[model samples]
Target: MKIAVIGTGGVGGYFGAKLAQAGNDVTFIARGQHLEAIRSNGLLVKSVNGDMHIPNAQVSDTITDITNADLVLTAVKAWQIKDIRNDIKQIIHEKSIVLPLQNGVMAADELAEVIPEKQVMGGLCRIFSLIEAPGVINHVGFKPEIVFGERNGVQTPEMEVLSQLFDNAGIACKASRDIEADVWKKFIFICTSALLAVTKTSYGELRELKETRQMMIALLNEIYAVSQKKGVKIKPDFIDKTIAVIDAVAYESTSSLTRDVWEGKPSEIDYQNGTVVKLAEKYGVDVPVNRFVYDCILPMELKARGKFNRQTS
Candidate 1:
């Protein structure tokens, strides 16, 4: 399959590299030092599963020279979507499937606002990865799945073909029955973990401490409640299922948001916490825990952005 990855970051690079490794036509759209590295030294993937460097996959700074992508993964950060929309539309053909493997619920809608609605696919990619260096992608943890589907829940030829593509790429991919529920399930856990992790010093400490778990549950309940109020149907035993996952995960593990909070890199608080609050207001529900979680992260926003060294007005 012909695939275009909009970002060469961990999620984009790792998945794209795997797809390319499987002998699929994959183009990586990237720029700056990372782009230069990929262009010169090739793209690298380092993970427990395995690692390899793809020297043949095409890399470009602009989409003007790109075309005919069967699937385009819009893996750019949430904030970059609006800015990159024009170029995104410029590259891939109209019938190409565009999947936004981003956090939160509105990513597909956000892309549709720019791209044609018929081609936008609802996507959820959960991978613990980061750009270890300019040209290198580090895939950590256990989850390496990519789930996506049609907006109307009907399995189209494109979706079936997509499932085949992902499987061939060696990703634990699935075309879900209820894609929204799957997205929300992960979102609930992620938002909760990120919010609670900011309160304490470290993920290990939080998981070991009683208070951290309490805060985690409270914040999770608030987000869960808000999800229900918005009429986004969740699994019948979602709460139990989520709680079970929380208990099963390694205590030392934390969300990338919390990692950004500590390292002082820009976090996805605006989309994660802010989105929950917006839904709360829409549903007229009191979301004090979520509100508090959002408020607590305000000061850390700049810190999460790596702006601690610089002064702010």
Candidate 2:
């Protein structure tokens, strides 16, 4: 299969390397030292499942460099989707599929707004991985699976073929009959944990303290309310189920949003919590917990981008 991996970050680098290792034609779209390193050395993945190295990985900084992709896996940050829409559209043909492995629920919709709706698929990934350095990706936890399907729940031959391609690369994948539910299921966990992690810094700490645990539950409940209002079919008891999954993870586990904040980098705060808040307003639902978290992190996010204005009293 011909694949274009936009944003060679943790998710893209690891999956693209695995696909390339399986002898598929995979082009990694990246920039800066990362692209140079992949061009000179190789795309390296250090995984708990197993390490992989693609010595001759095809990589490029320009999106137009590869135009005949059968599938385009967009792994950029949630806030970056709109910015790269034009670039992505330039590479995909009419038959090409675009799967966004982002954390937010609106990623597929965001892509559909720019690209053809027929070409966009609802998708999400389960993996705890990150770019440890230029040309290097580290997969720390999770079995690393991808769940995706047609936006309208129709089963297409392309979905089956993509699943097979992932399977051939020894990657766990599922073609869901209801991809929206799958995306929301993942969103509950991410939004709750990510917001809590911003203040607590560790999953273990959030789960241990009674006050923090309650705060996490409150955040989850608020998000659940917003989802229900938006007509997403999430269960009422999803908070309990999501908390169980959070407890199962390592105590030290922290979300990418938390990591990005601590590392002083721009994050998807506006897209994740901010999106929830936006939807809450649209649905006339109160999401105080999500709003509070979003407000708390906004200053740091703005400062990271050199947009924050400090005032003197």
Query: How many backbone clashes does every candidate have?
Result: 6, 0
TM-score of each: 0.92, 0.96
Local error of candidate 2 at 213, Å?
Answer: 0.6
Using lDDT as the measure, the top candidate is 2
Clashing pairs in 2: none
Indicate the residue-level lDDT of 19 in model 2: 89
Best by TM-score: 2
lDDT of 1 by residue, 17-61 (tens): 998999998899988999999888999999978888998669998
Worst 10 residues of 1 by lDDT: 195-204
TM-score of 1: 0.92
- Tens-digit per-residue lDDT, 98-204, candidate 2: 99999988889989988999999999999999888999999999899989999899999989898899999988999999899889888878886456546755888
Query: Number of clashes in model 1?
Result: 6
Q: 249 in model 2: Cα distance from truth in Å?
A: 0.5
